[model samples]
Target: MIVDAWFTVQQIDEATYAISEYGHWEKVHSFLLLGTKKAALIDTGLGIDSIKRITNQLTDLPITVLTTHVHSDHIGSHGEFDSLCVHEAEEDWLISGIKGLSIDIIRKNIGRDITLPTPASFNPETFTPFQGKPTGLLKDGGEIELGERTLTIIHTPGHSPGHICLFDKSTGYLFTGDLLYDETPVYAFYPTTNPADLVASWERISSLKGIYKIYGSHNTLGLEPSLLNEVKIAVRYLRENDLAKFGTGIHRFSGFSVQF
Candidate 1:
């Protein structure tokens, strides 16, 4: 069975927020401090009507939305925000605003008559299509200073060539995009995910200690200290182990060829 449109928000800390995707759950998004003069949206949901409706209902605090990557689902909706930032490697997709990859996959999975309000899907007059101008170019070591808060830009490419994560050094909070997600990492059938790099990226992410609250692009951060360890174990396991040994669910996303 398929799922319908829906949105969810979770409070990460005093001011941080997490936004989720509409259907067939994966990749949890994080929004930081809507009330703090300048709030930062870590990742945008699929640019579907469900996400758009909920985004409008949320606090309108001169938001500065920045995507962790340019996967169809994470960035398609971001076109609505006037100004946002993204990793340099994915800046082209953000500017190009191409569709076809994840959009069709999600729609098919949902089995619903849904249409995203993007330039390709809808006209500007009908609804505001997200055509954001990128103001910041995120580098591997660059840091984003929003008001008093800061999110370090760590380039952990794997899921995509320029995938990034936001680390709040002050709070020791890590907001990983698709590069480090809770779901059994999906490999690229259409040339999006790079399996070899994804497994290695986990090693890089695990190096950071005292990471109190960790998050993915799909679900609320469960303070899963187990996640950190699990990631490390998963990495080494994939390096030597045959992915085919796992159940079909693990390989169903992209075949058993690539390990994550």
Candidate 2:
């Protein structure tokens, strides 16, 4: 394994790697999935450092950055990649900046709660989230073929209008993005989020068959597929009690929790 001052690289398989920033409070994780002809990078980490440095060491194939969402933390290093693809719902936000989200809040969130030394280039005061056009737009059910491997895009919105989850059909690996994760509450209480849609998304992913493992963008590196069962129960509970709305506080399930 390659050692770095930042970014912990873990091998999930010979063709897949999890690039994580455990030092950051969010514990953001970016994935590198290698195919025979190309590679797919799922969301860059916080712009505390250049994630391209790690990707370069992982593969020589052309990298296609598949953004799970346009959140500041997820797209921090988006500018470092040339071929970027985001959901059609977030295409405008990608070209422009996420509306109503203040740079001050972003800077504050990115700068604080750090346990590791950040790169000198990272200046939260002046730190700007990557904003530009995407090479293409992806939609729900859209399939991306990286040589022999195929990633199916799931439009699991609610956390954000354009938030998505990627499913690796061949490996049965589901990259849930921010839509699902353990530890901290999955956020849907923000003005931009829709709690109802979030529950629906949880139901959608929970119903997905043959998921071997779940890879969320933050906190834990991987979750067992059995957690999907818990998600199903949580979704039913949230919808049954009519609690899938903002200001509902935190709803804890057996394996995960959500705030709406």
Candidate 3:
């Protein structure tokens, strides 16, 4: 029987691809970090109902979902996973709901105002229904075993202090959340966004060796190996706006290098 998978494995390695509910916001591509027996889903998309449509296509294998940060688009379906993992720093944000300003940014990015209904368990007075919950807290170097494989949680703060990247050192695959993207990274964000820390994250990531390929939480799966280098393009854009702010040269992520 043919089961249409929500994620397609990258032809080159232990990587899987899926699109976020927000298709036009280009940086919204999510990924599956697969080991031999189990897989880790990185970043859920903007809309929970849409997440069900995408996840319904996934394998019956037990899956654990994690978010790079608590932004609404990245953690919309947090409750779907048996256990949801997020950086400790974002725990409050997840429980309280994402920043009000980011939603407006998303609306502008998507070119429309999409108001999602709250989940039944939520109280409209203090809580939002559509916003999901985080079940576990993760930190840098934290490891999770999915069957025979182990994925390392690299805390690459900046985009958000708790922002994380999943690295499969064995396969050289890094699931970079918004901290590194193929588009203009938005440094001017609400709640918490430190361009300096983000630049440091680039330096930290550049040290990884044997990184066969890189994936983004947003729209960047089709990035041919060659195009993956465009993270520098993002850094350059950020630099033009304020080079001195980052404390050093821009750090970019192409498939081969994270330029700083």
Candidate 4:
């Protein structure tokens, strides 16, 4: 196991690892999946410290960074990677930055709520999220092949216009990004979010077959596949009660919660 001052690395399996930043209040998690030919890094953690330092110690293969959405916390360490892939819907946001989201708010969020010491190199006052052209754009049914391993992109837009979830058929692991997580509410109440689309996305993913485990981007690291059943029920209830819209508050379910 590799140890660091800011990031905590945990092995998911022989070829997969989870790089987490527990010092931040969000407790963001970034995943690294290694294959015979290359590797895939799913959403870098908060840029409080360099994620590349941790990744460099994990694998020697080339890494393709897959952005879940254009959120600041997720794309914090994006500048450190060469090959980046984002959903087509967020291609503009990735290149030019998200519209209307001020840097002041971003700085406040990044600077506050710290449980551990950040690196001396980090200065939230001057912090900026990475903005550059991605090497490729991902689509709903796009497939990324890493030697014998394959990852299917599920365009689960709602949390963000281009928010996506990755499904690994070989291992039945669903990387839900911000679409699902435990402990904290999966929110879609932002101006860029669509409550209806979010609910539909939840319904879409809940019906997926052979999901062995659920790995969300924040909060708890892994969830059982049974939580999908609750998502199914929550979807029906939210739609039936006409609550899939803004200002509905947080809807708590058995294992997870959502804010519309």
Output the worst ten-in-a-row residue range by lDDT, candidate 2.
115-124
Could you tell me the lDDT of residue 135 within candidate 1? 83
Candidate 3 per-residue lDDT, tens place, 139-163, comes to 8999988766788999988777788
- State candidate 1's TM-score: 0.74
> For residues 113-223, could you state the per-residue lDDT of candidate 4 as single tens digits?
899989999999999988999999999999999998999999999899999999999899999999999998998898999999999999999999999999999989999
Worst 10 residues of 1 by lDDT: 248-257
Range of the 10 consecutive residues with the lowest summed lDDT in candidate 4: 43-52
Candidate 4 has an lDDT of: 0.94
Per-prediction TM-score: 0.74, 0.99, 0.72, 0.99
Per-residue lDDT tens digits of candidate 2, residues 130-232? 9999999999999999999999999999999999999999999999999999999999998889999999999999999999999999998999999999999
Any runs in candidate 4 off by more than 4 Å, and if so which?
A: none
Per-residue C-alpha lDDT of model 1 across residues 199-228, encoded as one tens digit per residue: 677778888876887777764454454567
The superposed Cα distance between candidate 2 and the true structure at residue 124, in angstroms, equals 1.1
Provide the overall lDDT of each model, using Cα atoms, as 2-decimal numbers. Answer: 0.62, 0.94, 0.61, 0.94
- lDDT comparing candidate 2 with the true structure: 0.94
Better of 2 and 3 by lDDT: 2
Model 2 steric clash pairs: none
Backbone collisions counted per model:
8, 0, 13, 0
Candidate 4 residue-pair clash tally: 0
> What is the C-alpha local distance difference test score of candidate 3?
0.61
